[model samples]
Target chain A: MMRRIQSKALLASFSLAAVAGSVIAAAIIYAPEIKPVERPLPTSFDPGEVAKGAQLASIGDCIVCHTADGGRPFAGARALPTPFGTLYSDNITPDEKTGIGNWSFAAFRRAMVNGVARDGSHLYPALPYEHFTHVDDADLRAIYAFLMTRQPVEQVQPKNDLLPGLGFRPLLAGWKLLFLHEGPSTRDPARSAEWNRGKYLVEGLGHCGGCHTPRNILGGEERSSDLSGGIAEGWIAPALDKSNPSADRWDEASLFDYLTTGIAGGHSAAGGPMGPVAEGLSTVNDADVQAIAVYIASRMKPESALQKAASTVATLPRDVASQDPASSKSTIAHPATDTLFAGACGGCHMPGAPMQVTGRPPLSAVSDLRMTNPRNAIQAVLQGVAPPSGRGPAMPGFADILTDQQIADLLGYARAHFTDASPWPDLTAEVSAIRKEDAR
Target chain B: MTVSLIVNGQRRTVSATPDTPLLYVLRDDLELNAAKYGCGLGQCGACTVHLDGKAVFSCLTPIGATQERQVTTLEGLGTQAQPGILQQAFIDEQAAQCGYCIAGMIMRAQSLLDRNPAPSDAEIRRHMQPNLCRCGTHHRIIRAIKRASAVLGSQNGKGDAS
Candidate 1:
């Protein structure tokens, strides 16, 4: 009886040890590792610091993503759409109750560099802290100072409308463990200061890769295809790196001019999401813009002789309007489309026309249909160049004037006539979608 | 709150919330009717005005933000007897279709020309893209800008005839 009781007690103790051991292991794996948030706070900063911060923020393009459709700037309520769900941006204003007014400098740093929030919760990658992780201490401080000085808007961020199983914030911990790369970007010793600066800006604060580079199923930037181009904000941000199709049109001079002034010597004009980016870049110093241009140019392979000759031909003024409709009708495979283009586009796009005197760039020079996505071209046609910039001919939109079918036909005809590139396969569907939205 | 601003070379004080859009203050309080409310959001160019010589969307800009800055609306640009060069050019080009977005377009164009008196067609298109005009008068608008540039250029003793 004594032996039996001793064996039973031994078994009980063994089970207790196993349970405790499991608990300890789970704590190590599941619990957030708390670090001392020791960074100092600033009560006030000088004008120079504030100015530097503002410049960094501009490079980040913070305002475009943070501001909602009608909400105040930086009072984040912007519903950023993702494949998983719509994530509402958090307000970064200095409001004590609802914003980051109470967050310590260390907390802000951790959030910026580590993708962790003030409460030790993992932040969604939607904030682009993955790229921000590369920001150095001084520049980050400057940005923080600039943000803190802004008017404290008393706005609470709305709840994220994320799809089920996606909003489980705890899951972000595992995601971070798998993919979050933390640390400042080290410069290559072989590169020049200008090249390094460009790389730092383009890769870090500029976060150019966030939109310009393609994303994987997990929504992270596909590193292997960096700057090869990606679709962003519903428009195809054309490739800036080696895969660039129209490399001949974008020399260093033109890129610098485009970045500084939002126009590339009549070769193209900034439109869609790039419009806002150009506006922001317009305010930056000339050297920085030039650096960006130099870096982007370096990424591309030199244009071949054939490409140069083809581009020259493409840019030449073509009289698509003057051709006799009766004679040219047989040459056009899509007669209806040809007719639509002639009636709607020929008046101003043709040479010597009244509107052409306004310095209308030839339609042949326009690379509107070259993008993998048809959104820009479709929107341009639907909206017309309603906002006429000085860069190119602002064609009036035919949304109110033409049917979706007619517009599709017109676009198809223009694409067929204009470039050597393949036409958008779903042209009709794209036009219909634009029409359904009423070109808002 | 009371905000003081230098509008079109005039000093004015107005009562409004701190975050109230500058466009409302200019239109409602200052009685400057030239800048129209197109989108009320920054997306439309209808409420463009020169904020310290830079063309910015007034509808998106808060009144408090413009306290020490110069705000130039269309009313300040010129009058019937002595219209501003850009405004006169717009008239000559007949750039106004419905005329709703013309004020904003001209203000934006004025800012552009102030910076670059003789901008290329591409430069103009890129700079003036932020302002939207619903009417298909973009060609005429561009023409008016060029004409304004020429007039200003000749006045400055440098003109691009090409």
Candidate 2:
């Protein structure tokens, strides 16, 4: 009986030891290192340093993400939609209660470099700390100085509505271990100073890859498809690499022009999310813009002839069909489309028409015609482009002006007459849906 | 603070902060309406002008940075009565749409022509790429530049032959 009792006691102790071991393992896996941050008493900074900080902020494009439309700058509350869910941006203003006004330099550094909150909770990589981790100490200090100098705004940001699985902060500790590469990057010795500067801005602070690079199932950027292309804010961020779809090669000059001016002559226009990025980049130094162009050009190899042909649609000038000797034979094949185009669009779109020479983008070379998807084209037709601010001659929306059947017919004609592209899928349903949604 | 500038062949002085963009000084102080303010940042070449004969965004260039440099705007190119060769070519080709981006386009084109008196169609397109024409006058713009290049070429040839 005594021996039996001893055996039971031993079993009990063994079970206790197992439970304790499991607890310890769980703690190690979940808990991040929580260090106390020390901050000096607040003091005014040098004006020059503060000015430099402001410039750096512009380069980083802090205002675009932080400020919601029609909201105070840097007061935050911008809803960033993601595949996961909508996450709200935080107020970075110097409000002690609502913003980062009370955050010490050490606390700010920890958050920027380590992606940790003041309470030692893991921050979502959505903040882009993965890239900002490479930001040098001097820039970080300057940013901190700039934020500290700003007027303290009293506003609280809405909580992030992350997808259910992402709500658990401890899971992010494992994510950090898997993905985050903390510290400054090692520069390649073979590269020029300009190339390195471009790399720094594009990879480190600009975080172009964050949006441009495709992501995996877990939301980390897919390493194999770097800058090949990705989707952001419901628009496709086209491949910046050799896979860029422009018929002509993007030389350094063209790339520089595109970045600096938001347009590359006949190539493409900056719209959607990229529009703001282009505007922000315009504030940076000319040399830096050049450097970025140099870096991007270096990545893109000259495309193959087959690839170029596949990419470029034969956007013949308007006079081509009307004047071409071979057009009579081709016109016989699709007389209905020809008639539809002439009636619907020929008024202003034909060669030498006043609107064609004046306000209208040539039907032949417009970026929308070349896109693989018909979304931009359909949207432009249904809801006409408002000429940019102070750049007047706004095109009227065709939602009320044209019937769905007529739009589809016109689109079909545009594809046949203006471009060599395979006709985009019938867009009648899409036009109808968009019009209904707009009405609502 | 007062900043002295050489604007469109005229020496002018304006009171503004040293860091103020030259585009603003030209617009607000000198009242030169040709150089537009499309994007306060230089993303739109509407604010492009020649600084020391090189095309630069006036919106991005600070007033302090332009000391002792010649700044040329579209107004300097020529007025409505007597347009320069490039300006006249643009008019002949109807190369402008809204005309907001025209000043910068002309300036960029001038810089290209100055460097390369006879640029190929491809070279002209590449050089002129920096100036955006949102209305898509690019094809016509190319033609105008080529037309101007031919005219300039003939003029040069005649001078040399004589």
Candidate 3:
């Protein structure tokens, strides 16, 4: 969020650069429209290739962004609110009218790898073509085959509402020139085949860095800080590298458990936007997920200062309000929220609780409570965690149950009791703000 | 391990493992049969009780965690002779078929009414989402909650039963 402020400040200079860049871009921004073809029957695709494509699609989490809330999968009206402005996802359901039903393989490839649409319009980077460009031709073809076979949904996604002057499509060619590296990714000679595959998926279709890496004002990922930390859907996707705030290191096993099942023993559960990602990966093949774990774990090295900061609180701090004689006059109920914790959260979060005995991470181990931003914690509380694998403890959201002040009190109590991190200032206001944001 | 709990405003010491769910302590050790164990996983609200005025799953809240909090079960709300407003509403409305989920439904509903004395029917349904009634007794249970809410709202001074 702090980085976002700095990026906003540079917008004036970037706008000047963009105007000059667009001039150069307009000269060479031509893409010959590939002729349309009749919608291919599902039977035309090889079953095995279709199945493989389905797996790849799940790994890519195609449905997460493409599908609008409570809308048909891949019908695509989901409004992706970026710092620049709101961009709507494209309908990729193969609908004859609105979707990619008429898209030929060449047209789809151009769009997938080069960010060009069937009508020769440049797509916003919201599609992550920079990463999609790394995917091999065969894999891209498989994905096309799978998408063409899906239930054809007739939906025309709303046009992107971008910042003024940013809507000029040719300007994106300049962005692509500077950012998009179109080609199959190279293998690291030192790494294993599985690790190489992991890198490909992570860099290509998985596009893990899209949410995990902070973006520049131009919306390109900050390559220097790949997967260090970033914001996703208003929640902090904590750093996955050496700067990871978890007291415990993310090994292959932990990463595998987390990526697949949502919850890992020593680490926090896959919360926020990652919830659906983990759930989607649950149905994927174990080998691919294992490979992903291998690469992700390899990235997570130990940093003592961060680990020390993340370590569980040695002792609970005394409540500062108890010293005040007027403390009993507060609106929040008496006997402290530890009792509220005992009631509302104790079942899954308290030490020695049932979920904890099953090797679930305690409140002390959960990174949300320990993170610098309170948004993740606030989001998790207001909108409870879904049991990732469908068997773990599924928490009911307290948004309807608890007030903002009550939620603030409970989290305040948790931070003081569980972690040594400095308490978040104005948690109640933060909760209210997050609630308002989610409402939008 | 011995755990001290403030149950029904009476300080009681019970010898049990620290991690044992408060549901077992209330039903087994303390012999308070009010909170029933329909689902140990907290999906069913049969084991819900008011822990310091907030309804929580007693089946999940460990006895260890309850040491610092005040625990109130169905028995604490009212005796058989003098039923609480919610309990009376349930009785008047005939909200139960098998009566297993009644206690939990009452506790969960009571927590909502406590927070919002005049919650809308939609709000009641949303608040009671976690609680389940297997006997298909939801219609009556909702009626009972509405009945109690109307009573509480109409009353000039709140009954200090809770």
Give the candidate number with the greatest lDDT.
3
- C-alpha lDDT (0 to 100) for residue A257 of candidate 1: 69
Query: Model 2 chain A — which ten-residue stretch has the worst lDDT?
Result: A387-396
Candidate 1: regions farther than 4 A off: A1-43, A302-331, A334-339, A352-361, A372-375, A383-400, A422-426, A433-440, B1-162
Highest DockQ scorer: 3
Model 1 per-residue lDDT tens digits across residues B1-162: 677879989888888775567788888888898899875535568988888777777765656455567888888889989999999999999999999999999999998888888988878888887788888899999999999989887888776522
Per-candidate TM-scores read: 0.63, 0.59, 0.69
Please give me the DockQ of candidate 3 compared with the native complex. 0.07
**Number of clashing pairs per prediction, in order:** 10, 0, 0
Residues forming the 10-long window of minimal summed lDDT in candidate 3 chain A: A322-331
lDDT of 2 by residue, B1-162 (tens): 676778989999888765567788898989998888775434467888888787877765666556667889989999899999999999999988888888888888998888888887667776765567789888888888887887788888843210
- TM-score for chain B in model 3: 0.93
Docking class of 3: incorrect
TM-score-based ranking: 3, 1, 2
Model 2: how far residue A321 lies from native, Å: 11
What is the C-alpha DockQ of each candidate?
0.02, 0.01, 0.07
DockQ of 2: 0.01
Each candidate's fnat, in order? Answer: 0.00, 0.00, 0.02
Cα lDDT tens digits for candidate 3, A195-304: 88898988898999998898887788888899888888878878778787652445677788889989977568887789899988998999999988877766775434
